[model samples]
Target: MDNVKKRAAELLKSEAVKVVIGYTMGTNGKPRAAFIQNAEDVDSLIFNAQCVQNLAVYLSKAEIKQLGKPAIVAPLNVLRAIIQLASEMQIQENELIVLGVSPDGELIDFQNFSAIEKYLEDFNMEVDAKEKETLEKISSMSLEERWKFWNEELAECFKCYACRAACPMCYCHKCAVEQNKPQWIPVAAHRLGNLEWHIMRAMHLAGRCVNCDACHEACPKGINLNFLTKLMLNDAQEEFGYTGVTLKEGNLLSTFKTNDQENFIQ
Candidate 1:
């Protein structure tokens, strides 16, 4: 933690970055996002298991871009998000600095996104035991059983939109749910509305989602919306073998190939 503080201070003191986005002490001794602009403020910055929020979400924000250039203290998920963002043209190269955190709590001074991608080659997209068990339980269900199970979960959602807000990939200027002219989705939080909202959001994030669990973390009702997107991610990986962050021109879902499987053509 001290090392991170030192580096952050050095960068800010040298004006290498206009801001250093990382975790800091919040109320009740918790952790939250901290935008450190001054060298002295680096003391508040921290990194740990409790600092679970993916700070990469701010990279796409117009307000954050106004800060000149940012140095984001990124975890593994945030690293993946950065590469994915770069691939989607959401962010350009040399736009910001990345303060990457390794698994052993060491700071990796990634000079560029390509280096992060090479580092990511060794790390597997492994989920925790709890998440693995939950996915297994869901996968064991029959089609009708799965439908019934998910509906029960979705019924509790009151459309707070915390899930959408927390997602880094959901950086659209205007969301489909917010559109009223075509009425893409109903305004109310009814069963149909909730169903459509989540399904559409999952499809939109099919290959784009990095399984950061930001949606799950931000859910006021503890709804596991991350699971739905995770399923979509799994489907894309299993079918297309997409690595989520190819640093390519187009996204997996947006691009099509002649050799793609026609199983869904019907």
Candidate 2:
């Protein structure tokens, strides 16, 4: 905690970063996003197990960008989001500073995006045992059973879009759900509309989702939206040998492969 405060103060005092984004105690005594511009306020920065919110989502906000060269106190998931955002050209390496925190609570100050990428190479990208087991269970079900499961889960959705708002990867200026001219998706939160919305969301995030689970965490109805994205991610990996949060390649869906399987096409 002291290291975080000291580094934030130094960054602010030297004008290296105009703002420091981190976590602070909220009114309900939970860690919430904190933006500190003054060096004296660095003491408010806190990092611990309670600090679960991904501060990386603020990087592309116009108001935060207006603050000028902000520094973010990022966790592993946030760092992954940064790498994904960088690959997508949503953020530049020189535009922001990253104070990365590993899962063990160690603070690592990454000087550049390259350093972050290298450091994250040792980080495990595989799904945990519990989630993997759950995914396997879902996979074992028949197609009809799987369809029924998703329909029942999605029926609780009210089209709140809280999941979209919470996801760092969902940075589109105009979300498809909000479109009206062509009305690509129905606005009503009926069964078909809800199913369409979630399927679209999952497909959009297929090879891009970092498995942050922010969408699942943000769903008010406790819907397991993460499972949908995870299933898509698993298929992407099996079919294309692709994963999210990498700089060496373009998005899997965007790039075409000559040897790609077309067994389902016919």
Candidate 3:
């Protein structure tokens, strides 16, 4: 924690970054996002197991970007989000600086996106064992059983959109749910509406999900929306040998290869 504060303070004092995005103690004694513009406020920065919120979501905020050359204290997940965002041209490498934190709680000051990519080479990108086991269990279920399970789980949704808000990759200017021109999706939180909303969310994040699990964590109804995206990610890897956290040009769904199998096509 001390090292993080020191580095943040140095960046602020030197005017290297107009703002340093980090974590601080909230009213509930949990870690929350903190924007430190002054060097003196750097002491409030804290990093621990509770500091799981991905600060990368703030990078696209108009107000935050106006702060001028922001610096983010990023975890591995946030770093992956950064890479994904960079590949999508949502953000630039020189626009924001990254202060990466390793799994062992070590602070790694990355000079650029290339540095981050090189550093992440040694990091493991596998899904958690427990999550994998749960996915396997669901995959083993019959089609009707899986449908019933998902319908039951999604019935609890109240259209709060907490998952969408917390997802770093969900940076759309206007979501399909909010569109009223044709009302592509129903606004009501009925079973069908909820199911459609989740399916749309999962499809949008298909090959781009960084496996941060922020959506799952942000769900107020404890809905396992991350599972949907994880399943898609697994399929993407198996079918195309593609991973989201890379400097790749085109996404899985956007670009097609001649070698791609079309066994499902009639």
Candidate 4:
């Protein structure tokens, strides 16, 4: 953590970065996001297993971008988000600096975000053994059973929009749910409205979600919503040969190819 603090201070002192977005020990004995803008404040920065918030979300914020050449302390999720965001042209390569943190809570020495992305090649986005078992259990169900399962699960949502707020990929200035002119999605917080919201969100995140699990984590209802995005991601990989955040490839949905399969239309 000292190495991170030292580099962060050096960057701030040298004006290499106007701000250092990192984690700090919160009053509730947990980690919280900290925007360190001065050299002396680098001591407030911390990184550990408890630091799970995806700081990369701020990369798209107009205020953060206006600060100029910001430096971010990126965990694996943040790193993945950065690559996906960069690929989507949501952010420029030279616009920010990265302080990469490993899963074991060690700071990595990366020359640039590109090098950080290269480092990410070693990681996999798939869920763990327990989660895989759960996914398989869901897969075993018939279509009607699956529908019944999801219908029961999604019935808990209260229209808080916590999932959308937590997702780093959901960076649209105006979300589809907010469209009042056409009244896209129902305003009520019932099961149907909740189901529509989750389905639309999953489709929007088809080729962009990094499997970060932030949405699931942030949900007050404790919905296993991560599975929906993971389903879309796996489908993108199987159907389009696109692995969402490959960094070298374009988005699975946006990139058109003549050889893409159309058998599903039949």
TM-score of each: 0.93, 0.94, 0.95, 0.92
Give the per-residue lDDT digits (tens) of candidate 2, residues 1-266.
67777888999999999999998988877888999999999988887887767788889888888989998988888999999899899999889888887666567888788788888788866677798899999889999999999899999999999889888889998998899998978999999899999999999987888888878877889999889888877778778877556865878788879999857785
Can you tell me which runs of candidate 4 are displaced by over 4 Å?
none
Q: What is the alpha-carbon lDDT of model 2 when measured against the actual structure? A: 0.86
Task: Give the clashing pairs for model 2.
Answer: none
- Candidate numbers, best TM-score first, in rank order: 3, 2, 1, 4
| Cα lDDT tens digits for candidate 1, 1-266 | 67777888999999989999999989988789999899998888877788778889999888888988999898898999899888888887688888888765688888777899888888766455687788889999999999998899999999988888778888998999899999999999999999999999899988898888989998989988888887776767677776656676478879877887757666
lDDT of 4 by residue, 115-230 (tens): 86788878877555687678789999999999999999988888899888888899999999999998879989987788889899999998899988889888998999999898
Query: How accurate locally is residue 188 in candidate 1, as Cα lDDT from 0 to 100?
Result: 93
Q: What CA RMSD would you report for each candidate?
A: 1.8, 1.5, 1.4, 1.8
Query: Model 1: which ten-residue window has the lowest total lDDT?
Result: 241-250
- If ranked by lDDT, best first, what sequence of candidates would result? 2, 3, 1, 4
